[model samples]
Target: MKANKAAVLTVAEKCKNILASNWQCHLSTIKADAKGSKGEIYTSKVKYIVKRGKPYVWVPESDAHNVNAIIDERGSLAITTPFPGPLAHLLKSVQKLPSRIALTGDVVLLKEKKAQLATEKLEALILSEQKAVNELSYTVRGVLSSTNPVFTSRSENLQGLTDGGENYNIYKFDLRSCTYLSGTGGTHEIDLGELQTSKADSLAPYSAMLIDGINQSESRRRALVLFCFTYLNARVKDAYILSLDRKGTDVLGKVPNPTSNEQFQWKEFRFTFKEEAPDVEALCCQLVEMEEEAIKKVSSYSGLG
Candidate 1:
């Protein structure tokens, strides 16, 4: 029989180890100042390196000045330490002592509380980044689908129908350096550099048109569904995000049945500046052709009626 394998250490432990051996925690302290303005007094030397799964703060109790300063700042004994070096040397040291060894007063409690809060925050950041990515995936799927159904939740497969007007500002590019990434600012690692969303202060109204292409042979109301696709660009028309549009339609194609071949014939419309005439002209021409075909379909339906 094969031998049993050891259970892996939890994600928190892994993250802790990563944080301990590498990331430096910056602790700020407010102190009374002579100039009447509040001054922050911090230590450059009180840094700690992660040593063998343990936080090794170098501001030892042996140093009277550092020790007193730590005590004075927190009103309890707390030493500040940033990650210094590797941890292999302190493996035996960690196993022998309690998880933490505090020589000072209420410092241990504060440190422990901080550690707990940090862990919870890290988990929250993970959730936030996951949410952003999940939303992005849905947006991509919306662009690819034959009909874009406005979904209620970011993850739910359910779709909803909406008038084309309310859909413009739904999918937005939030342009701010919100600090919850990596282990710091917001943890969304979407580093879309250089091509950031425009900060232009212009009053241009976005247009939306819903076209239910005429083919009334199918008896079901949901059977005939037309999807709207919007190509978005922050800088110029040539540049495109993978999915820069909201799922603005609620037409889920036939399911399970192999024979249902419902095709969506779309009438495209676009807006562009007159200065960029060449690209704008091409887009307009395409729209005209698409509109002509849509008109022909409408005329045929009129003739049948």
Candidate 2:
């Protein structure tokens, strides 16, 4: 586990969440010449699904990368989380980079039964996200539908992706080594076993909705900024939850320049939960408690009854 324990997730867990959250990845393979000596590397953007912590992708049988991968099973995948849905506003800062992972692995073609399973997993992933988005608040749904390309571009074309059947070849990426780049935590090398044993954050699917709701609510936003000011000792001009997991919340704060009030800079801060929340209900309760604690601390600091 290369990730710091104080952080919300381990490097491996973050890798799992990132893989589960996004469908598109850059697939890199080596094309060998007639003598199979030095080869040319080719990278192609392709849709993918993560099943059991392994990435699976499908491409037309004749695709150059596919053909290259067939000749040499060694390949790699670079995946990054898509633009966050309605909460994009919170992550607009340059400090708020995307979570990404680069995986070096053996890309082996899946046969009959394995291919069927991989295909089904891809279909299920698309359907599950659609259903989950549908259950979100109307505002989040509307914003996601219009502004988020991840959903807007793929939702309608999902059927076409899997319908290619015989024309597409399914391949599973067997992880050899992984490197995780945390948006704020820097980069770390993750072991294969560590990644294979870890699970995606339980709150991953609902993170956008939860963060967006807090950002949209005046009281919640006020409480969050106040918490940063009072507890974290941050001179915050404004603050919002950048991301959330069962382990904690990452807050992005805008602070006015010490020399010039008109100028501001962005900084990221982490607040780990006392205990991991098991579900949305528990997470909400923890957030409420945090808000209450912040309010109380603010009142005490100001000597107000």
Candidate 3:
């Protein structure tokens, strides 16, 4: 049977509190066939920890059997105290074996016994994968919500990047390395690599080019900035693409006031192509780099330096 949202949240809270008190929990996996007719059951003892208010189940490296099989067996997880403890009471309360509990979090397989924060583990996973801009954007949002519950509770309609009531002139950069006269009546052949500052005034034409290439609405642009930066790094206030070229891209944005939502300061970041020039993969690398930087900054800020 499908679990409702209220049931999921209630179970999550109960699991969190149980882990906080017991430091470990028994995880029973119930696997059902594709037709939802019959199933098998498996059980394991896992160390549990609460990080940023979320409960994560950790399986040690020494474990002989892999839990992935059961976890992937198209089933729900029923968590309770281990045998001989309150297991009887727990099972009696549910009135069912392999009870369905919908949990929204992660399962970590650890190589070492040392306990690490969930945020740290997530950052490590994201960095190791080197996800592209679009993938990184979603991953950053997930990390933000998982690490900071308060962020998810904030009003969704708050003013942000797209709300800035200023008209922006967009520009595009040419792929070639040569100079060409401007189309807007200006006689200047621009060498993209030689461009220095990514400041709005300095990069007017180039900025316009990057902005024009984006097909998303203004609201989406604001949401993208929040997803790609601020949400990933609490220190980041905003993010905006300044320019894009075959070799690199520049971004201009803001850093939030950790103390107040009404205050934010502007900042700029540049990403150079990691792969060969003119390849679409280069853009992917650049976007991944942005996410890596945000993760790094946030990690350091949290005293994980």
Among the numbered candidates, top TM-score falls to 2
Task: RMSD for all candidates, in order, please.
Answer: 24.0, 4.7, 25.7
Candidate 3 lDDT (Cα, whole model)?
A: 0.35
Q: Which residue pairs overlap in candidate 2's backbone?
A: none
Estimated TM-score per prediction?
0.19, 0.76, 0.24
For model 1, the stretches where C-alpha displacement exceeds 4 angstroms are 1-14, 23-27, 32-45, 49-54, 60-184, 187-305
Q: Please give, for residues 1-305, the per-residue lDDT of candidate 1 as tens digits.
A: 11112222222322332332222233333344434324454433233323222333323333332333334434221221111111112222222110111111111212555544434443453354335434543323322232222211211111111122221111011222211122112222222242122111110000000111111122112222211112221111111011001111112122222344453221212222212212212322333443454445545657952
Candidate models: Cα lDDT each:
0.25, 0.72, 0.35
Higher TM-score: candidate 1 or 2? 2
TM-score between candidate 1 and the true structure: 0.19
TM-score, prediction 2: 0.76
Candidate 2 Cα errors over 4 Å, as ranges: 1-7, 32-38, 60-62, 85-96, 126-160, 163-167, 208-223, 258-262, 292-305
lDDT tens digits by residue: candidate 3, 1-305: 12234222222222232222233345444444445423465566544434333445544433322443334422222333212212233334434232112232223333333333443553443343323323434433332222222121111111111234432111111122222221122333333333221111211111222233331234334443644443433235445454344444444456765689787654545444444333334343455565566557656768895
Using TM-score as the measure, name the better of candidate 1 and candidate 3: 3
Expressed as tens digits, the lDDT of each residue in 1-305 for candidate 2 is 11257646777887887776566789989976555625678888877767777788877676787667657889999987555543465566364667789999898998899898877876887687666656755544432333333343344335567665547888888888999987766989998888889998755655555666666566676777887876678878777777677887777788877789699877777887877887655677777788788888888878993
* Candidate 1 global lDDT: 0.25
Which ranges of candidate 3 are over 4 A from the true structure? 1-236, 255-269, 274-277
